[model samples]
Target: MQKGKIGVSSDNLFPIIKKFLYSDHDIFLREIVSNAVDATQKLKTLAARGETAVSVENAKVSVSFDAEAKTITVSDNGIGMTAEEVEKYINQIAFSGANEFLDKYKDDANAIIGHFGLGFYSSFMVSHEVEVVTKSYKEGSTAVRWTCDGSPEYTLEEAERAGNGTDIIMHVNEESEEFLDKARLGEILNKYCKFLPIPVVFGKKTEWKEGKEVETEEDNQLNDVAPAWTKKPVDLKDEDYSSFYRQLYPMGEDPLFNIHLNVDYPFELTGILYFPKLKNTIEVQKNKIQLYCNQVFVTDSVEGIVPDFLTLLHGVIDSPDIPLNVSRSYLQSDSNVKKISSHITKKVADRLSQLFKENREEFEKKWDDLKIFIEYGMLSEEKFEEKAKSFFLFKTTDGKYFTLEEYEKLIADSQTDKDNNLIYLYTSNEEEQFTFIQEAKNKGYDVLVMDDVLSTHLINKFEQQYNNKRFVRIDSDVVNNLIRKEDESEHLTVAEREELSPVFQSVCPADNGVNYVVDFKSMGENGQPMVITRNEFMRRMKDMSKLQGGGGMNFYGDLPESLNLVVNTDHPLVKKVLAEKEAALSADLETVNAALAMLKAEQESLEKAKEGKKEEEVAAADNEKLEELQKNISNLEGEKRGKLEAFGKDNKLAKQMVDLALLANGLLKGADLDKFVRRSVELIN
Candidate 1:
């Protein structure tokens, strides 16, 4: 027997291990089990190379817990350390045996998992004392038992063992007693070691007998020694991949498609990525991709390992190249991580491109569900954007899907404006903007359904990518103005427009956070009598603000919505309203206009007489007369506007037209909608 303090530069090493070695105390089980797996794999590697006579078959790692004893033990059957090897590796705190093993067996040690020797110390986090009983595979080697409390001091001595292996026994501390529970220990094992390369046993398999679960003789293996990702892609079928996905996420829906990633030249990376049916919201669908180093689970937050948008995908990504101690800042700067990120982005884009090229009809069927993810990727990753352009689809309001290039060709001849810019018409809501979409379709223009949360940002990216291309919402303007082929003239004169503007403006909802600007356009008698449209730029900005939801963008979000109330002058209803207004207020306006003309003439004459004159040179009486003339002119104008507004308020047809436009835009609600219904019935009657 021998006793000594652990070799270390600092006396605070054990305290650091106990308090801050790992973020969670439950991680101790993973560290211990992973070490056991490494030991077991090392034996297999040595046996394969004919370096050892030890049999590698039926080798396994088992985790058992004693509730009353408040202890957890992880045992394995593999290459273990002799007494001298234990003194060197165990006495030294940071010395890693896996690293030295890899240096010796660099070519054949692919399955070795441990990179940091401190993994053994992690057991001290949850234990008041930890004991290791190991027997090396060397012929006539003596078994040894190593013991250490939650301190630098430890004991090593010869012990008895059945075979070559190691057993880690942890006496649970007061605060870490939860690990003594079998169920809790099983959960931790399932989370971190469920896909380990070695079979991991927890306890006896259970059977439902005598109306209760009874432990059977069969060992209850907690892990699948070989997961789908560890096998060659050729060996996996659709069902096999789906079964693996179910194992990863028990309650998740089946994925739309999958990309089996196998890269070895640049850096060893093998895993399966599945494109899940993402919800319209991006945040809720993130952090589903689990990352691993070799077969040991690292994290589910893979934002840095893959691009931010790729976080939307669900799957396993195993790479020994990615260090086990993951930090966001470290991942961002690591060269290997950058390469892996680029590779994943390329893989996703390539898979999508293949799906589109091979079976476009099937791809189109899934476009609506796959759109948000693709759009988010294009908006976030530039390299992905370059590749995604080949597979990105534009879905029309009529449910037809087309690639960007194909749609560009389809609309190049018809949708190009007079400025030689290609106009891509789109609608966020097909039902609410049905009138606008139909009008566009009537003119042989196709409208896309850009309704995803990322659509606004994506369109902005597209606009930046192609200066000659523009994305215009179908309801952003009248059909004639949406893709202008030539200059157009207003059908109503200035005087006529002035008379009609007030009539439409009077009925526009004032309390709603919406500002309506009345404008007249020539759409022929066949066009709708009224149409509501929003400014594309402003609306897109507000949409982006809502999606991003913070910072200076809140300004745009808080601003009231502004829409164009386009009244078709050629429509018979609008013509009738103009005629009716003329009959009702023309006489009253004329009387007021005559009085305003005389007052304005006197005022202009007085202003001409005082031209370039000093204030002192102008007569006091002349100034007083000018002031009186201005007051009378102002009063007459007010009187004229009052009569026009009064006539507008009394005009039911004008109010009904405004309400119809509001209703079509989904803005009219509550009492206004009810009023529109009642007024609509009366008008029909």
Candidate 2:
């Protein structure tokens, strides 16, 4: 027996390994099992090269634990380390400038483990003592045993073994005794080694015999040695990709499609990415994309390794170029990782473009499910945005799909405004905004359905990306004004508009958090009598504020909703309401208006006298006289408005028109809706 301390400058290495080498102590199994796999694979390579005569046909890694004894062992049938190799690889920590490395990475546990080749030592994280019984495949080589008790000190001695392989036996510490549980060990193995190239055995296969589970003689392999992603894309069928998806997500809905990634040059990368069916909401399950290094599971939090938007995809990504132990910050800065991310984004875009080109009808069927993902990618990744334009679809209200370029061309002649701006009309809800959508359709305009949670942000991004293009919600303005080709002629004169404004405003619902402005537009005799529309910019800001939840946007959210009660002047009902108001309140309004006119004339003359004069230059009596004239004019105008509003309240047709607009907007609810319904029944009776 030969005993010696591990050749390291610091005596505190063991404690550091046990306490800070890994964030999660459970990763010890992954490290040890991974090492076993490397050894087994190396032996296979040597045998294939005719460097060794040993057969590697039965090569496998097995994990077993003795709960009573509190020991877990990982054994492998492969090229094991000789005593000299053990001295060089295990006894002597291979990291140069050890003190500096330790100091630089003491706070970053993951960086410490992989950066300094401390994978084998991770076993100390869960073990108070660990033993390695290895036999080299070299002819006439002696088997050796290595023992360490969570310290730098270790014992190397000759040991008996039946085969040329290695066994890592860990005496789990008290805190990590949970590893001794069979289920726990099995879970760890399944998570970290489920797709290893080499078969991994956890225990014996079981069967339900004699009304109870009985262990069979067959080894229960925990992994698929050759998963779907490891094979060539041409060799895989659609069902094969689906089956792999089920293996990754047992309960998830089947994905829309998949992109097989197999790149060897610049960087080694292989994996399958599935476009999962997503909900309209952005509150999705991210971190579903499992990342691996040579099939050894590294992490599921692949936010930086892939573009942020791509994290919504589910499946596996195995890249030897990505180090096993890495921080998100390191991944963000790594040049190779950047290259891999760019390649993945391009591949995804190309795959989508191909799918759209090959079967556009089928692509349209999947557009509702794929819109959020494609839009999110376009908003987040600039390169992806450039590629996505070829496949990103604009789904219209009538269930037609068109690419950005296609849709732009289709609407160029019809929807372009006099300002040379192309207008893209859209609706958030097909049912709620049905009236607005129909009005747009009546004029031969195509309205898109932009209902995803990210739609507002995406629309903002689109406006910034394309010149002379605007995305307007169909209900944002009256149809005639939405894509105005020229200045529209008003049907009512200034005095007529002023007299009718108070009448329409009087019946507008005084709902909390709602403000209504009466507006008039000539929409011809066939148009609806009244329409309620929201301002596009203000509404979008509020929508974004609700989605993003903070910052200056909150100001928009907190403001009352401003809606335009657009009264179509050409409609017969509005014409009747105006005529009725003129007859009922004409005398009272005339008396008030005559007094208001005289007071306004006096006030305007006084205001004109002081137009170029500073405050002190104006006489005190003149300023007082102007203030008195302004008060009298305001009072008389209020009196005139009061008379008009009184007549408006008595006009049932006016109230009915306002209610119809509210009902169409889906804003009439509870008592207000009940009132409207009751009034309609009374009028009909």
Candidate 3:
């Protein structure tokens, strides 16, 4: 027997492998099993070419655990290695520079997994010593046994009378005794080898006989040799897909749909992607989709392999093209992964489009559930955005479904402004915005309820895609201003406006966290006295910034909410308030107006003669006369706004209207809300 140091130039290889790799130590099982599978596959290829003597009809890989001997043995019926093959492959360390080897793979998990021809060496990670007993299927080959401790030294000798293939035994290490546990071994098997192409047996089937679990005579295979994804899509039924889903996730609800992805041209990719019922926000549910390489389990963390949105799906993806590696950082940059991601997105969009075209009624039934996924794709991927335009839906307040074009046509005649820009009105809450909805419906305009968190983002997307179209929240503005044909207002004289400002200002709450600018509009007598509304652009920007992004929020949130306190001056109640204020402050305002008219006439005469004069001449002319007129006018307006505030403070009707408007906007809360309710009761009584 002869042995040589592992062909590494430096002694630093062992420590690097132990520490940097300790994080992914569990991958050792996958590597060993994969190597076994590779050997087995090679035997099959040889047999297909008439190279083997043994009848290769059926070959299996068996894994056995011995608690008493503290050992784990993997026996595979594959192309066993001869003594010379072991000497060349196992005895010589293959003096290759370890740095160049490790440099060749900066982050590929597959490279370090079985590198340096170290498929069998992984057993040493968990075991203090490892033994390999082999009988090659080659003609005139002798059986051999190889042993190695956790070091560079190894021994090879003639030994076992094994059938064919190899048996690798690992003596459990002190630091890794946990792998000796039956349950632990079973868990590792289930995690990394549950869907192998060949049968992989772990132990015997257990039975609850004599009040205890006893090992049954039958073998307990731990895998489905022919998983659903491996079969032809035509050969499977809905129940089969459902069963496979159950097998993948025993506790999950039934998936809404499944897309069987089998592509070979651009890159080999096979999987069953299930659209699970995501009733709430997308939470990270790990181990939902198991990745496989040539039917050998690799890992469940497919974030790099699949798109971010696809993580919400649950199923299996097996590809021989994906090399089994140790570093995920390398796979993330793999060109093939991007191809796979695009293909999956297209396939998903195609599936939804097909479903909608084939059975629209069923698609409509699931639209509410399906909207989130389609919306996410549209917002994230530009390509998906293009495809989703065809199948995307718009729903109306009247419980009608319409495509974007259809909805545009339905609202075009009535909702379009003078500039021909179409307006799509929607509400976040049907109950809270009921009054606004009614007002819109009163004018023969439809409102769509958009309550999703992504609705703001989706609206932004819609405006970008649809020409001369805008999405407006139902309660954004009053009925007339929403789709303004013209700004037609009946002007009030300065004296008249000064009289009515106080009656409404008196009732408005000072502590409410909104700014109100009062406006007297001459609507029909039937209209409400006051309507509170906010600008749509400011409101939506503030909203979307809270989600999709976190920028410009301080700017928006810190700014006082701009609400228009529209007082319908034509309403009889408003007219009555003006008359009452005039009756109350007539004497004071009359005296001030008379004094102000005389002063204003003198100033206008003085200004009319100096319109084209130089600044010095105007300044010289404006001496004592200008100072006195300015002081008098300022004092009058100051007294007037103060009186208006005073009147607004005492006028319960005015306060009630302001609060009512706040309540309508869902902003009346806490003590202010309490006062509104109390005032509401008093008014009702």
TM-score of each candidate structure, all chains considered together: 0.95, 0.93, 0.88
lDDT by candidate, in order shown: 0.87, 0.85, 0.75
What is the descending lDDT order? 1, 2, 3
Q: State the weakest 10-residue window (summed lDDT) of model 1.
A: 324-333
Q: What TM value does model 3 have?
A: 0.88
TM-score of 1: 0.95
**Candidate of highest TM-score:** 1
Q: How well is each residue in 530-631 modelled by candidate 3, as lDDT tens digits?
A: 888778888887776666456656577557777778888777877776776777777887777787788888878877877887867776547667778788
Root-mean-square deviation of every model: 2.2, 4.6, 4.8
Residues 1-685 of candidate 1: C-alpha lDDT, one tens digit per residue = 9998889888898889878768776788888899999999999999999999899889999889888988889999999989999988889977889999999999988588888888899888888899999999999999999999977788999999999999999998898887777788888999999999999999999999999999999999988888999999999899999999999999999999899999996999999999888777675756588888888887787877888888888999998888556111133348898898899899889999999899999998888788889888888788888988888988887778888889999999999999999999998888888888888999999889888788888889889889999999888888899999988875667867776777788878889778989898988899989998899889887888887785778989988999999999889998999888878777887877788778888898999999999999999999999988888888877777777778888889989988878887788899989988999899899
Selected candidate, larger TM-score, 1 vs 3 = 1
Candidate 2 to truth, TM: 0.93
In order of listing, the candidates' clash counts read 0, 0, 15
Considering TM-score, where higher is better, how would the candidates rank from best to worst?
1, 2, 3
lDDT of prediction 2? 0.85
lDDT of 3 at 528: 78
